[model samples]
Target chain A: MKRVLKLAALGACCLALCACANRPPAHALDRTCEMGGRHGATGVLEYQCVDGDGVIRERPQPIHRVISGGRNG
Target chain B: MIHRCPWPGEDPLYIAYHDTEWGVPERDSEALFAKLILDGFQAGLSWITILRKRENFLEAFDGFKPETLARYSEADIERLLGNAGIIRSRAKIEAAIGNAKAWLAMREGGQDFSDFLWDFVDGEPVQNRFASMKDVPAETQASQAMSKALKKEGFKFCGPVIVYAFMQATGMVNDHLVTCFRHDEVKALSRSS
Candidate 1:
């Protein structure tokens, strides 16, 4: 019974983490930024995304350096 | 991939609006009028606040019919104050009525409001293909011109920033990113229309 209860708790922890991870990330909110219409300039205008609620999470950036195939050193 | 505007989960209403109409161009006179007033109310508040209260606005403003709204009396204002469907500010509420009167006056002068509005861009929707969010702007020359014209015509609550947002919402411009799926679709519709 003790072992079974421990496994159940571990499963619940993983489920909670997965649920939290599945929520929309901050960069996903940037997808709504568009540049056409009356404003003739380019750039992301400040828009209230998600009704001003919810936390914005930053994604981890890649650390590896990539070399361009067409560029010469 | 399904292109969605950032800020989904703010609320179901906001999510629906972002997915369906945030950057979509609008053209109908009534729809334009509704958006104009709504954007003005959004001056210092989150759009989600406006969206959540849209039903109240619609009910209070007589379904956003400019002609009908133009006839609103002081009693109407009193009635709206007690209703919780829209922003309860006296100034903003009164501005909607004042703007409706101005809109009707413009119509009486043989000017189609849509045409008058579209004239800023010479009847063609401006198309933008920005790759990153940093490439968009808050105001533009076109919005400035439209703002000037509307103010000259006695309309209030229409600043350049508001006009620019109006233009985007009403299809006067296409500000979708190249990678966004709706960008090409909206562009094609603009070309065909």
Candidate 2:
């Protein structure tokens, strides 16, 4: 019984290491999108996930607009 | 309801500008020069303020002809300062005159003003499909380079931030929100250009 318990603990540790090794960094996940070209009547930008989080979501996402700094008067 | 950029709101003149002029590529060297001067004047005021007085500005500035403006005398400056129809900031007026001289110099040097400005964007408009105002950057690397180049060429009030806005309005870059009706239309115009 003691040997079995030790093996089980070792397996759990290995599993955790494997999981982490397979995961991409948080920032990498955020930056994984690819430009998918313009879409719809309004021609908004469409980004497709080429890997990780975006692939899992399975839907193209629209990113934020870059606001120019100035009064724009 | 037809969707448009939120910035234009419901003002008729603003809407008209947004629909017909804003983001449309202007390749004419003289027209581009005039717009740049107008944008410089827009530094501390709302665009509508200048837009409302555009006719007066055109009349007062002699159609923004660089040949004419480069020769503006002190009397002309004084006359412009006293004009109630246009923004009467002496500094801005002076900059316009100086810019005209700079423009003339560029032409004399055999550089096309429109080509000089468009070269920053590789002779085409940058089509950006930003989803909202928040995503639109106030300045970009291109604008920074353009600003530096302009200042080196003696143009004033052409800072990166101001240059970026000018880029958007002049269609060197298309900043209309993807949800705005003008976005695709402007993009199409860019292709045609």
Tell me the interface RMSD of every candidate, in Å.
18.3, 12.2
Q: Candidate 2 chain B, which ten residues in sequence have the lowest lDDT sum?
A: B41-50
Per-candidate DockQ vs. reference? 0.04, 0.01
Model 1, backbone clash pairs (residues 3+ apart or across chains), number = 23
Rate residue A64 of model 2 by lDDT: 21
For the second chain, the TM-scores of the candidates in order are 0.92, 0.98
Q: In terms of docking quality, how is candidate 1 classified?
A: incorrect
Off by over 4 Å in 1: A1-73, B7-10
Instruction: Assign candidate 2 its CAPRI class.
Output: incorrect
For model 2, the stretches where C-alpha displacement exceeds 4 angstroms are A1-73
For candidate 2, lDDT tens digit of each residue in B83-110?
Answer: 8888777778899999999999999999
Candidate 2 per-residue lDDT over residues A1-73, each given as its tens digit: 9999999999999999998874555655664554342211122233445554444322322222211112211
